[model samples]
Target: MELKFKFAIASDLHIALPETVWDHPSRFHLVEFSIPALEVVLSHLAQLNLDFLLLPGDLTQHGEPDNHMWLTARLRQLPYPVYVIPGNHDVPTVESMDCFAPYYRQFGYKNPSRLYYDCEVLPGVHLIGLNSNQFDADDGQIGWIDRVQLDWLESVLSRVSKDKLVLVMVHHNILEHMPGQASNPLSKRYMLDNADRLCQLLHQANVKLVFTGHLHVQDIAYSDRFDLYDITTGSLVSYPHPYRVLTYERDRDAERLSIESYRVEAIPEQPNLQHFSREWMGDRSHLFMLNLLTKPPLNLPSAIASNLTPHLRYFWANIADGDAEFSFPNFPTNAKKYFEAFSDRPPADNNAILRL
Candidate 1:
């Protein structure tokens, strides 16, 4: 039998009900619209007859008890199944994992005690959710799959047949969507610490597709070495406020996958939300851009960085709004080249259908 299905992914919902939102003077997330924006997306998704929905991570603003509670209740109301993983923000402390399972138990978990889960989302198709939040006091909030989970993943992959399609969902990125994600000091936070080990295992198992979030960029990174694709979605409450719809199909001789991305441009009260959000990001981009230049990989002096900040004001916002292309002709050649690389958008950056 041939298997085909459609699914949606909306990452980093950061759902903050009115009561849970905190005051932050320099906050980048417009989390107040978390609920409405999600509702808008869900309203559209609900009509699509999706086989399931995949919420990769950052399901709440700060993993507040109330926020988790709210998200669980809302998720229960959806018509289709939903699968989730805990992000660094979801479980602020390691102990919070204890309470995580009960909230999302109905979603798709054989054993709540183990944060990672695997289930057959469709015939000959599997969905695996792995928790990447490593909260060790010495290690801090790094992305890692501990030995126990790694072993569990190995056992699970070992049992699957060669014809089956394995779709892995993790909170952190396994591939470098940005420049120097693994080696760059500033970009390491967005990647899995021991990604090479996991990639080797997946490659051996013939796993092709992975859905991830947390960097809040609309990016798809493919590895020719492993023949793997890491598709990361943007935040629901940040600039571009995007989500994705993916359709997978298979037949006797061919397997095909299609990906299409969409953005939440407005809520009920804010019809021009896209315009407003971009401006908000631009207004606050000065310090962020300055830090980007002075940080590792660039390490420009404070004064030099400050002078160059204005020209690249919407640098990150553009990244968050994916398929970004950057070109600078006026600046010094080296500085211009260094900053422009961030906007590389190949043909497969946004949407495409591939034969597997």
Candidate 2:
């Protein structure tokens, strides 16, 4: 018999109520649209007849109790089951970290005491939700999957039927979405500290798909050695606010997953949300662009970095919008080539079908 299912992924919601909304002049997130944007997406999703919805993480604006409460109440009204994990922004502190699982108990956190879980979302299909938030002695949060959870995952994978379809969800990227993402100083923080270990276990179990968020880019990265795909979705609170709908099918002959992405083009207040958000990101891109120009691999001088920053104003916004093809005919050859590498390299970012 053939097996098939449909699901949606709306990641990095950053849901904030009116009173909970805050602002920073240079912040990338236009969080004021959080609630309204989510409403728009959910309303559309309600008509899709989805089997389930996966909110990979960053569910709230900043781990506010009010925001969490608001999101939980809103999700309770949805027609399909929702599964979530904790993003660094969702549980920013040690105190908030301890309450994450219980607070979201209804959404995949079956055990109030445990932060990670594996359950059969459908017959012959299993879903694993993992907690990637960890705190240091000083209580500074880091992106990591502890040894205990790794061991638990190993045990779980060992027991799941080999023929079953397994889908893994987490808040941090398990594969590199950009060039040198795992080692680049500015980008590595968005990646799992021990991604290799997790990848090894998944590869061993033949788990092929991973859903993630937090970096806020719409990119599909593949691991050649492990034969795994990391489908990372863009944030709803960022420019070109986006979400994804995926359909999976399997039979004796072959298995395939088709991906299609959508953007929230407008909201009541912002009639041209895409235009507004793209400019919003560009207006604040100077400092960020400078960091990239001055960082390790490039290490360009301050004067040169400042000169190049203005030319790359829409660089990140383009990346966030996904499947970006880049060209800088006016830039120095080395700098031009380096920046161009950030564009979609293969297999398409926003839409494609994967054969497994």
Candidate 3:
């Protein structure tokens, strides 16, 4: 049988109403435009005849009940079916965490009590949305998949037909998008705590495509070990504000997936959203760059770190924008090479066609 479908992903929506808006001086996300940016994307998508929309996670500015309510209500108004999972920001506290599955119950949670679910979105397409938000022993949230979910996943995959296409959607990344991402102190939080176990199950199940968010970058990472592809979308409230539309086709001959990414460049409040957001992130990049320089492998002296921070002002912004290539010819060899490694390695981040 031949199968084809089109879908859209708008991850890390971080939807915030005016009353729920909060501020932090050094924060990377711009929650102020979340609502408007989503509206723009939804308006555009409504015209696309999308099979469904997948919001991988971070559906609110915080785990505020109001924000969740607002997002669900808005999602209901859309013409297409929508599915969501929980991000760290979506369920920050243990108290609010239980409410996530219920609030968006209609989206994908057939069982409101459980945080994850598997459903057949189309005739031959299966979507498994996993909740990665978990509270640690100290009640602080972490990105992880519990053993119960793993066993449940194994059972579900065992029942699935090998000819059907399985698409996994989770909030935390299962593959590293950056160099040393899984082990890097600064980036490990965005990655699943037990990614190896999850990848094993995915590989065994022959699941090829995984959708994720939370790192807030436009990246498509492939794992040779698992033979899986992780397509992570950037935040709608962050720099360049990207979302994706994908087309998947399968026939007796072959299968292919095509990806196209779009950005919310301007809203009424910000005429030139891309330019403003890039500058907004650049203004806040100093401390982030300093941390990168002083942490782990680099561990540069404070004086040298400060000197290099200015030179890398737009480094992360370019990364978030995707398909970025970097060079710092005048900088020290180690620093230059280290920064360049973050560039889009291969296959491409923004747009591409892949054989499956």
Model 2 residue runs over 4 Å out of place are: none
lDDT of each residue in 81-189, candidate 2, tens digit only: 9999989888888777778887888899989798899889988899999999998788877888998999999999999998889999999999999998989989999
TM-score of 1: 0.97
Q: Over the stretch 1-356, how does candidate 1's per-residue lDDT look in tens digits?
A: 58899999999999998988976877889899899999999999978979999999999988898999989989989889999998888887767878787788888665878799999988888888998888666746789899999999999999988888899999999999987778877778899999888999999999989999999889988889999888999998898899999999988888888999888988986798899888888988998888878887678889988999999878888888888888888867778988788876553656878767
Model 3 residue pairs with clashes: none
Question: Per-residue lDDT tens digits of candidate 3, residues 1-356?
Answer: 79999999999999989888899898888899999999999989988989999999999988888888888888889888998888888888888767888898799998988899999999999999998888889997788899999999999999998988999999999999999988898999999999899999999889989999999999999988999999999999999899999999988999999999999989999999999999999999998999999998898989999999999999998888888999899878888889988878777999999898
Q: What is the C-alpha lDDT of each candidate?
A: 0.87, 0.92, 0.92
Q: What is the lDDT of candidate 3?
A: 0.92
Better-scoring candidate (TM-score), 1 or 3: 3
Ranking by TM-score: 3, 2, 1
Query: What lDDT score is found at residue 171 in candidate 3?
Result: 94
Instruction: State which candidate, 1 or 2, has the greater lDDT.
Output: 2
